[model samples]
Each structure stands twice: as structure tokens, then as C-alpha cells.
Target: MTITSSPWVHPEPSQSQLHLDVVPENVLHALAAGESASFVPRFVSPYLAGPECLSLWRMRSGQIVDTPTDAPWITRLMVDPRVTAPVGVAGFHGAPDDTGMVEVGYRVDPLLRRRGYARRSLETLLAVAQGHPDVRTVRASISPENTASRALVSSYGFVETGEQWDEEDGLEIIFEVSAG
Candidate 1:
């Protein structure tokens, strides 16, 4: 399902809302305010520090999830950088299966704990995901022990699918939200 034929595409946001073009400036201000870190491995994975990592971390492109199957309609969650402090990021993954399904995985900035940024970011990303014609479902994989993250997604209509996994990061909970 190419984006061109997808019913999800729509007009951009209002000037008041944060969008891609405003991210870099927002991030720079957030860094200066000490509200968030630029790109620390302790907060993110060391593997995310490469050139591609910077692009992903900055939300400059939709490259957060790179797979041959994810060539189209995959987008990064944009942050206000200045106001957001980027405590977390919403990473989107998708494929061209014509089912309009996408997945969002995220992480938060450790310093800006309990500020509801993750929830807000996820909400915004979900709205964007729903606007795409090829995105009928959005999914997420959360660490079971991460109570805050679990609560955030669950509150926004995501439901656990009884799926669990033991990755290098320990237990993970899979959640999904329908586009409708």
C-alpha cells in the first residue's frame, strides 16, 4: 500500500502544534534548558549513536526503524525539542502489506521523569499514524517492569495481546491499538 493511495494522508498541523520543521530548534532549546540530554547512550542504546542514530534521535527523518519492508509511510515521532526535552522517543515501524498496520516503540529521557511527555508524544504519534491510509493498526512493545510506560499506552486505548518475551532487556509486553 503506497502512501499515495493511502487514505491516511491529510493536511499538516496548525502553526501552534509542533511538526517536523520545528524540531531542530525545539531540541536545541531543550538541550540548553537542561530539560533533556542531547543523545546519551545511558538513556538510549550505544548502537543508536551512529550517523543514522543522530538522525533518528533528532527525529529529523523517518529512519528510526529501517527494514526493507518498512520503506514507505514509516515516520518518526517529532518532539518540540525545546519544550519536550526529548525524554523519550516514539519509533514507528511499518510494512507495505496493504493492511495499513504500523508499530510504535519508544524510550524516555531519564532526567525528565513523570512529566507525561511520553504519553503526549505517543498520542501525537498515534494521531499522525491514523492519518495515513495504510496505517490501520499501531502496535508497541513495552518492558513489563516499566510501569509508567505501560500505564501511558494502556490509557490511550492500547490493549495487551498476552504476548511476552525475554529479550536482552528482560520481559517485554506487546500492546496494540486499532486505527478505527
Candidate 2:
């Protein structure tokens, strides 16, 4: 799938050369409506608005409705400029809470897995958290079966704190790291 080239938004560059462009609400609404073309032409993968990403667009749309300020924190498209296509998605669940903690989530296209996209996404989130005055902690709840995710977080000094049963994700092992 191809997407016409367009300028990337966020100026914060990453080691992976992946730009985590915040997915705008208009685009989210269009993708939720099953029309990827409803969005401005961006250098992104067709998968961003495909059926595979429907639930994400839908969920984030609803989230923006209730917490408009969380828009920027909630979702981003992980795009590789060299390829001018999205490799995956990433960002926090929402703004930092009262405890100064923000939960992170990301996913790489199955075909693009193990290419360091996920790592770059997590690193970006960590860097954001570290730099934001309101953020003091970064959290990730990964499934125990997802050893790769666990290892990734561990390499970054995240500590296993506990586990929880998620309605949609089943059991997940919780990990956290100081954003400082």
C-alpha cells in the first residue's frame, strides 16, 4: 500500500530516523469511518487507515472526545522518512496522571517487526517523559507471553512491579521506569 509524500510534523528526531507524527483528530475520524483518504496526504503506510487499524482510530477518536488535551499524547504514527511509510504506531495512553506517570503503548506491523521501530517508539516516549516537567515515571504493561516486549523494557531499566488482568489484553506484567 502506498501513501503520497507529505511533510512530517514533530521536530523531535530519533535515532531510528523515525518521526512519531501525532495522528490528527480529523484523520482519526476518517479512519474510523473507514476512509483513509479522508486524511491529508501524508507519507504513511496504507495500514494506518486500513481495517487492521480501525479499532485504534475508533478508540482514540472517542478518547479525544472526552479528553481533548490528550490528543497529542495519545497517538502517533511511526514513520520512516527514508521509506516515506509508517512502520508502526506509538505513544502514551494519555497525559500524565496525578502521580506523574504515563503509560505507554506501541505496535509494529507484523511484516516490519524486529526492525527497531518499536524500540525507537519506546525511546521517544521515554525521552518525552523525561523532558516533561509533569512526567516522573513511565509505565508499560506487557503480556508475559511477549518476552520481546519484556526484554525491551528491561534493557531500559524498567522494573517489574506487578501484574494485572486487562479486559482486552488478558494478563499483563506491569513495568515502570523513572522518567528522570
Name the candidate that leads on lDDT.
Answer: 2
Best by TM-score: 2
What's model 2's overall lDDT?
Answer: 0.79
For every model shown, what is its TM-score relative to the native structure? 0.58, 0.86
TM-score of 1: 0.58
Clashes of each: 12, 0
RMSD of 2: 5.5
Residue-level error in angstroms, candidate 2, position 115: 0.9
Model 1: per-residue Cα lDDT over 1-180, one tens digit each = 233212221134442243221223343333324344455432333223333345443333333223434433343333444553333445465452467667776554455556655655666667767666767888878787888878888998999986666544567888988976
Off by over 4 Å in 2: 1-14, 37-46
Clashing pairs in 2: none
Model 1: residues with Cα > 4 Å off, grouped in runs: 1-78, 81-87, 96-98
Count of clashes in candidate 1:
12
- Each candidate's lDDT (Cα)? 0.52, 0.79
